[model samples]
Target: MLQMPDFLTLGHVTRDLHSDGSFSLGGTVTFAALTAYHLGLAAAIVSRADQQLIPELSRYLPNIELQIQPSPQSTTFANQYREGFRTQYLHARAESLEISDVPVQWREAPIVLLGPLAQELSPDIVSLFPRRPGTILAATPQGWLRRWDADGRVWPTPWMEAERILPQIDVLILSHDDLLPFADGNRRDADAILHRWSMHVPLLVATDGRHGATLFRHGQTQRFPAYPIDEVDPTGAGDVFAAAFLTHLHKHGDPEQAIDFANCTASFSVEQPGIAGIPTTEKVLQRMNEKKNLTT
Candidate 1:
């Protein structure tokens, strides 16, 4: 068995298609894991990967190990834009990954980030992460709110098992729009919303598009303004943010620094298209130092 890396992110693996006909490999775990690897962390991706795609993905990223569940085919997705909104369609059913697929050695990883896409990261997956010392859990709730119709149409569906999963999360990241439907419009202020959510978990974060993000922890809250950028595509920016945030925590253990690092990292992601736009840590730091907000 391969030794467990320091950080492991679990989620779906998909090929993304933008409206411009640009196609690239995507999904939160894919981009997030890569960001962690680039930011000086030992990173691995536990995904639902098929035999066919695994061989190819391995070739592109040989250094990054994949703890993939055996599937008949990889999960395939195509997204298009209507105005600034996005519409998604699922092209294939990926093999659902189970706790049994997790390697014994992987439990040694100090941090585990759950990057759910589709319905891949279910209650079963939440229960699988070892609840022990030195291991932290982070989750993005987008995966829980997604649903597909018989016609293959995809959209946000209101179903959050967060209350059940809260104890497992050391940090929970999500956008205001992602959970608004499930939040029942009862949340008036963003901070208030976070407070309500954190009643179950100590650390909760609610992200707002272009307005930056807010973090609530132990009765304290920290807010960061989203860096201004001409958005070429906002596709994987959230995942990029999560990846950088978690990487900083793994290395520095300071929430403030982690949020700033993540803000800079995500600022760099939206200036390009899909995964092709993901900038290196040096590139992000350079732009941050230069303070040049280049819009693509």
Candidate 2:
């Protein structure tokens, strides 16, 4: 019998090229799956990538089960950061994922994260799983909100399927940057849009890098501050946050504590490059305690 995973993520695994001519495994599913694994869950990934990336994924995520749809090439990205702002380029894209790509047994996963990258996953992919009590379906919709020009320069595009997708999920996680294109960089406008979307989903979270995150629930909003840390690389921090929040929420059923744990997890992620910075549960709890001590 195939063992059902505790946490499952669907999307594309990316090959991220760095300025120093180095490359590493990336993508929202990559980070989120690793985060769940490190947090002591039996995590699995459903992604589309080239066969070459299979070995790399195995090395990084030793215990996690990977259901990969073979593609000629993996999704590829190059990021240029100038003065704390990042401009991204998409060089190659892998094959798109369909409902058929997901395993039958995995469909019953209690926790599912739709972590699309390069728009490889369609909005209808949400229907692949059964929605029942105690099941948490969360999405990090960054990929759906992105578009690239002829030169493959990536830019934000509105989430055109929000009306169709929002009501189907339990939690929605997105970054402030993801909202900027929709709100035209207007804070109030972004909050308005968030408020509107929050009504459809049970929980809505918007992460602002370093500054912290805001949570929307029961038609009310609460802000959670990011844990302070000297940064090394911010790549995959939002994905890390979403995974941590969902994992904690699934186990403890407390959004407030989940966000605090997520904030601490994300803080640790930025202190190192790639998934090396993702913290263990003990480390996150230690950081949480230290923060409480300072405040007390």
Candidate 3:
């Protein structure tokens, strides 16, 4: 019998290339799966990677079960950061993921995170699991905002299915950067965008890096402050936040507590690089305890 995982993420595992030709394992699945594992959840990933990259994947992905769809080349990206700004380019893309890719047994995962990094997952994939009590469905729609030029220079594209899809998601995680195109770089414009999107999504978040994140639910908006800490690489912090929030929400079923735990978990992720940044449950609880002590 196939074992069902507690947390399951759907996306492509990426090969991130640097200017010097060095590559690292990346993508939402890579980071989120590790975050879930560190949180002590039985996690699994459904994604595609090139056959040649399996060994590299095995290095970072020891305990996680990977449901890989075969592809000639993995989804590859190059991100160049200068003065706090990043310019991203897509070098290659893996095959699009379909609902058929996921196993029947894994459909019952308590926390389902749909994190498509390159528009690889089909929208219809949402139908796979209907709304069921105790089962949460979350999505990070970064891929829907992406459109690459001929040279693979990635730019934000419009998402057409907000009305149809957002209603299906229990938790929708997005950053200010992810919605910038819709907001036209204006902070005031972002409010309108968030308000529009929140009409369909019951729980929606718009993160603003170190400052904090804004949560919208049931027509009420609340701000969740981020923990201030010295930062290193912010690469997977958002994915880490998404995983932490979903895992905590699954276990605790309290959005306020979950966001607080997630913000605390993500604070640690920005302190290190890559998967090394993901905090263990012990570390997160330690931070939470510290906060409680400070408040008391």
Candidate 4:
């Protein structure tokens, strides 16, 4: 194996099958890793990208540290929807990461983001680093609950392992709908359920469509309004937002700046399709600068 890069991303890789003529590549791992690279971070990705997709995945992927694993079968996803509503289905097995696969050089790194696509990604992955240094950002429960039927329709399953995973996450991000599985689809009851979910995670965020999102940290609630935009295809917007948010937090160490940057980045993402919507860090900065100028 080549020397593993010090910066790493643990997440999923899925073939995003859409209704349009476009069969694009997607996943938290792809968007986040790429966003980090755009922001000048040394980045690496560990995911299941079989022989076939690896060639394609390599092209869009910059020359950086990459770890590819063979799967029983490559993981595939069909994201089907009409208008703004959407549903997904899984068609194949995604790979899993053993503790042994984590690079020794990364043992001391201060930042790691845990992102997953399907059920194959386990909370047990966190156990791989008991003494590992720094923060661990987890896009969980949302990732943990994903399951696909034999016919490729994605649905929710019990994330029995979430208890183990929650305690391991420093920052957790999920959509308001992602809480449905745990809340039994009860929107009104999600608040109580989320409170329990946040006990283990120091910072927790839940985004609710155009209604905006909630941030819970240090026993206080802060809400940020979602920038209104005509969403074209919101495929990877959340992942991109999380990537931008994390980049800001890591680079500037300020909560408000991170949220503002993240909101702008995410709003920018929804204005286009797939990964094409992910803007560069400079674009994000420029947009923020514009917003600040108008407000002032």
Candidate 2 per-residue lDDT, tens place, 1-296, comes to 66899999999889999888879989898899899999999999998888788767788778889988789999999988899778999999998998899999999999999998788889878988657898899999999989999999998888889979988889999997788777878988988988999988999999999889999985699999998889998999999999999999999999999999999999999999888999999999999999999999
Q: After superposition, how far is residue 221 of candidate 2 from its true place, in Å?
A: 0.4
lDDT of each: 0.77, 0.91, 0.89, 0.71
TM-score of 3: 0.97
Error of 4 at 25 (Å): 0.9
Worst 10 residues of 4 by lDDT: 131-140
Rank list by TM-score:
3, 2, 4, 1
What is candidate 1's TM-score against the reference? Answer: 0.88
Give each model a TM-score: 0.88, 0.97, 0.97, 0.89
After superposition, the stretches of candidate 1 with alpha carbons farther than 4 Å from their true spots are 18-22, 183-193, 218-220, 290-296
The clash count of every prediction, one per candidate, is 2, 0, 0, 3
Q: What is the lDDT of residue 203 in candidate 4?
A: 80
Give candidate 3 misplaced runs (Cα > 4 Å): none
Candidates sorted by lDDT, best first: 2, 3, 1, 4
Off by over 4 Å in 4: 1-7, 20-22, 82-84, 131-134
lDDT score of residue 289 within candidate 1:
69
